[model samples]
Target chain A: MDKENRHHLWLTVPALLSIGLLFSAYGLFGWTSFYRATPGGLGVGGDFTFDNYLRIFGSWRELAVIGETLWISFALTMISLVIAVPMALVIARSPSRLVRSILLFTLAVTFLSGGVTRAYAWMVLLGNKGLINLALVHLGVIERPIRLVFNWLGVSISLVHFLLPFTVFTLVGAVKNLPLSVEEAARNLGATRMTTFFRVTLPLLSSGLVVAASLTYSLALSSFLFPLLLGGGRVRMVANHIYERLFVAYDIPFAAATSAVFLVLSFVVILGFAGLERLVRKVVVR
Target chain B: MNRRSLERPYGRLVPLTATLACLFLLLPVVFVVAFSFNDGAYFQWPPRGPTLRWYVNFFESERFMTATEHSLKVALIVTPACLVVGLPTAVAIARGRFAGRDLIATLLLSPLIVPGVVTGVALLALFTAVHGDLGLGRLLIGMFVFGLPFAVRTMVADLLGLDPRLEEAARNLGATRLRTFFLVTLPQLKSSMLAGAVFVFVEAIDNFSISVFLTDERSAVLPVVAYQYIRDFDDPTVAAMATLLIALSCALVFAIERLIGFERMMHINRK
Candidate 1:
């Protein structure tokens, strides 16, 4: 028994040690601000105070920035879902092997290239003297180039391009899980195609949609590279805000506070969505 | 006859629409490939001329070579470390029947769920709190943290699918528990381990967000180097580097596919 206990202890100890090490590392980094606030800045001598939190709330500029960040995140999520859902449905239900293979390859390429490559692609496409502008001029649509990059529109387009593949993949999984027989049965009952889809298929696909939305929203909210490069510092997301705070301002406490807020907000959004999904499921079952 | 003909057209429409969607997705990638060989330095839609100068330039550059080496080094370190920590935890979770199993699983998988940027920010915060600068140690720690959830989840699913009776039979044959684990159980887990390794390798190599937060110039990985060049200069050198990366990723994918049929290898989510 003693030997067995020792063996189990040996097994558990390493895991515990690793976990402790990770947590300790995290705690140490997080508490740096608490130990030493910047000179002429809020000191960390007292117990954990709400000074940083209050300052964020008290300042209108900060509050507006937060609001703008949330707004962009929300918009990106909604727009990506709108584009992704139909694409996912087409891919899932389509019968052509060539089409399926091509779609999969596209998804794989897009995901593999990701933020850096895609942003570069967009730059080439949207630059004043770049492809789209050149094409427009050749066709006599516009005499001069229009400003596309370094703005909200550019940021949104780049973000959607980056996120669309993942959304489609997730929704495709959901759509695939759905038993085709149920939809077919509804159609066989003399219901219209739209009716069958809306009444039967949509309900079943909601869970997947929720999951996709949560993932998409979180991704959009925390996106840094795409917005930073494409937005040209004009459009700031929460992540960009945090990066600027840490690197530029050297304000660790405020950055920590901002990160904390962002974390809590994301956690709340996820939990709320999960709760709503559960409630909806319960209601439907009952 | 009328209904059959009607359905035929509808089926054709589905294929057509799907083909269009695929075209939309592949267009940007196709553009990248075509431009990589363009002789012109500028990013023109139709190539002014075709040449292999950029690719040649990429091969000759010592900076690109160093960046590639650094990326490989980081991935090599991260992949094994992830396996070491991740596999045992997966085994424990699989074998043990415990309360809060779901919660533990979720916690293990949470890093994947969190956005990369948030993970980066969180890690940055954590590092700063510890008075540690972002360097090799920090980068490894970041990779391990980001890579763990994926490794654990994949390995756990693999373990669950495997029959425990094989290990039990080995033990009954007078083998010690450790010996059975090494001789019998470990060998059978090759495919899962391979899948886990490939997943971790791809992730470590491709990871930008956390690495961006953690790396300084001395420790900078390939993706960051590529990012800097693109942002700073918009040089065609960036295009060459991206082409190389795409080729490398495709090569890795093909290699894995050769080992295990592409379709099976492609599906990383065992659950």
Candidate 2:
């Protein structure tokens, strides 16, 4: 028993150490949020207070930043889902091998490139002299280049691209799990295809949809580059705000406070989705 | 004979939507590739000519080359470190069947769920709280945290698929536990290890958000440098660099796809 325990401990030590380091880091971060900023702007030094937290909530600007972050995150998740479900279904059920391989290759390229390159690609496409603008000019569709980059529109487009592959693959897994015979039986029994899809297929994908949504939401909320680069410093999300507070403003306490609120907000969103998924599971299973 | 429910446009709609979505995903990538050859400095349509100047410029620039070197160095180091740490934990998760196993798994995977910005800031704060400056060491730790969960998750999935009987049979024939794992089990895990290594390497190289916070003057990675360059200049050199990245990523994906197939390699959540 002793030897076995020792072996188990040895196997787990690296993972334990990594997680331990994270907990300690975040714990100190959470603790630092409570410390009042010293009068001099050098560092935090005062006794415990809720001033940092209050300041984050009390300011109208800060409140709007949080709201915008949540809104963008939610919008990206929903838009990606709307776009991905059909794509996933086709990928899973397509009869043509070429179509399947092409779709899979597209997804693999996007996923492997990760978010930074994807964002950069959007910049190239959406810039003033970019393809869209240039095409619009030659066709006389518009007299001037539309402001696509450095705004919510640019951020949303890039974010949706960044998010689509994950959702599609996830839904592919869910769609593959579904027994095709059930759908076939429903169609054979006089149910319209739309009705069969709505009553049967969509509900069965609830868990996958939930997981995808949560993933998309958190990524969007945590987005720094999108808003920083695409937002043109005009759009500020929670992550960007925290970064500014820490580095630009040099307000460590305020940044810590913002981080804390952001963490809580993410937890709330996740738990809310989990609850929604439970409700969905109950309705779908019955 | 009329087809059943020919009224429904299911065939047309599904393919149309899938094509559009794939186009949306690839449009930017195609843009990057094409624009790199544009003769103009800024993005322009109906190019005056096609030239390799920007690609040449990207290779010629000292700063860009240095950033690429740093990124390559960091990714090369982090990949093996992640696998070294993650592989054993993956085995334990797959085979232990012990108390707190689920909790351990959750904790290990928590970095995936946590916001990268939060993790970045938390690490920043932790380092500052200890009076340490942000540099290569902190950056590696932050990235290691980000990549470890992915490595472990992939390995765990691969490990769970193995039949225990193979190892058991080996053990029964007088092979020691360590010897069984090395001679029998490790070979089976090669594909997963490769997948996880590639993922970690790509992620570490492509990392911008967490590394953004940790970057000092001496430690700017390619993505960070590219971001700063784009912020200041709208040149096609960044486009050329981005094209290089797209090429590298495609090569990696193609290599892995040929090795183990794309879907199996990347479907980390596959049951």
Candidate 3:
């Protein structure tokens, strides 16, 4: 065989194998509703039906849970972005070795700690007998400990902490790669520093902003351990809710529908952003 | 040069804010370590007295040991599997110009965009649908799905930076495609492959979402076990476990840096 054919053969085997493995796995997981059982079975043995999708729409509780999950995820993403952007800007522009080292250490810790461990740390801090309560009691901030654990606030705080490093890292890349010569040229032409930043730096950095925001948004949306542990069942993100339906409720059909909704939502958002990016690129070129 | 005069003050302000941001990020992790040493069972700000009981308790506990073992086993298996799939995928994407390349790349990375909970649920469903029940095989498959994309992306970046002419030169010498890849391409790709492997291992070891959905008592991983301890019991044992895992991750990171150099690996990851 020719070299091209030989290479193709080698590539084809693994590529086909991966596709088959992944799709077959998807099939087995009831990813498609081709196989389903009625509501009476204790396990996964059932005939195929669209009952799961119907059940998801029919249940107000499930709908409400999903709505709440989206709200928290979006909120976390927005808040983290608000905090992370300036921080990224600082890290990019800073000249201090001490400052850089500190930032590096923070990234290391954030990346190393798993979602559940971070949640537990927050739980300790926010719980009645936790650190925050102890400080509050000492300071007389309140007569008794405030209820912080197993709440939306706690969940948000932990999720933001978890996602902060990623936001900074992505944004830093965007900001650092930006061409500074133009900004300097604008300054030489008598533009004020503020004007230069708002007019030049921000616009140039917008691509990075979009990338960081979309990434953070998707990450927060899919986060489960934080909401599960920190939210204390008070905060049920879509992912966790789907998990509960599958594991606790054993409602495979409904779980499948929930998964489908998640997949569609993410796909729509991603495609929308991709289109926006294309539009932005065209405008930039023009 | 003109911007320097005006930009100087703003640059000075950056150090202060960056320092503060770093503090905020490190606070929780520092707290975890501090609380682990607190004499009180509950997390107290000022330690009543420092003690090593939690660490000792963690080591003695059968559950923690089993979970640690399980986590290590999964990481060992999952990291290599991810590399096996990811390296080839990277090679194909980075070097080959083919139809549907973008789509294939997207498909490989779809797991990263999908929520971990969803991945876990999807994998659980997929496993049961195919095998009638979940087992180690399913759990490993789920971990592979999650880790593969990251490995592939990192390796692809690494491969893109490589000089393709070197491989072409080897091919000109009448080396077969397989021989060229193994002798000429593989050695050059080692650092990238190692970096990808370490990345996958860390991700796999720390993952709880899939483990939660798929793990049984016999196959329970460390994160799941640590999570259970934290949930059912309020104790420092979880903290002790976290400390161990943190140490393990740091050691791996250090080893990777020693092997490939930190800057090189970071560059690949950033790319």
List TM-score per model, in order. 0.86, 0.93, 0.90
lDDT of 2: 0.82
lDDT of each: 0.71, 0.82, 0.74
> Model 1 over residues A77-112: C-alpha lDDT tens digits?
888777776677766665665555556656766776
Question: Model 1 chain A, poorest ten-residue lDDT window?
Answer: A4-13
* Worst-scoring 10-residue span by lDDT in model 3 chain A: A1-10
The model with the greatest lDDT is 2
Q: Give a tens-digit lDDT track for model 2, residues A1-286.
A: 3355446646888889999999899888888888866655537787889999898788998889999999888989999999998888877777677877889888888887766677777877888877888889889999999999888999888888887887786678777777787777777788776787788778788877887787778777788887787788887888888888877788888888888888888889988988988888788777
Query: Please, what are the lDDT tens digits per residue for candidate 3 over residues A131-207?
Result: 77888889998999888879887887788889988887778777767787888877888887778878987778777
Docking class for model 1 is acceptable
- Report the error of model 1 at residue B139, Å: 1.3
Stretches > 4 Å off in candidate 3:
A1-6, A28-49, A90-93, A96-98, A136-144, B1-13, B98-100, B132-135, B165-191, B261-263
Sort the predicted structures by lDDT, highest score first: 2, 3, 1
Worst 10 residues of 3 chain B by lDDT: B6-15
Residue A198 C-alpha lDDT in model 2: 85
Clashing pairs in 2: A150-A230
Q: How do the residues B80-177 of candidate 2 rate in per-residue lDDT, one tens digit apiece?
A: 99999999899888877567888999899877877777888788878877878756788888888889998998899988888889988999999988
Q: What is the TM-score of chain A alone in each candidate?
A: 0.85, 0.92, 0.86
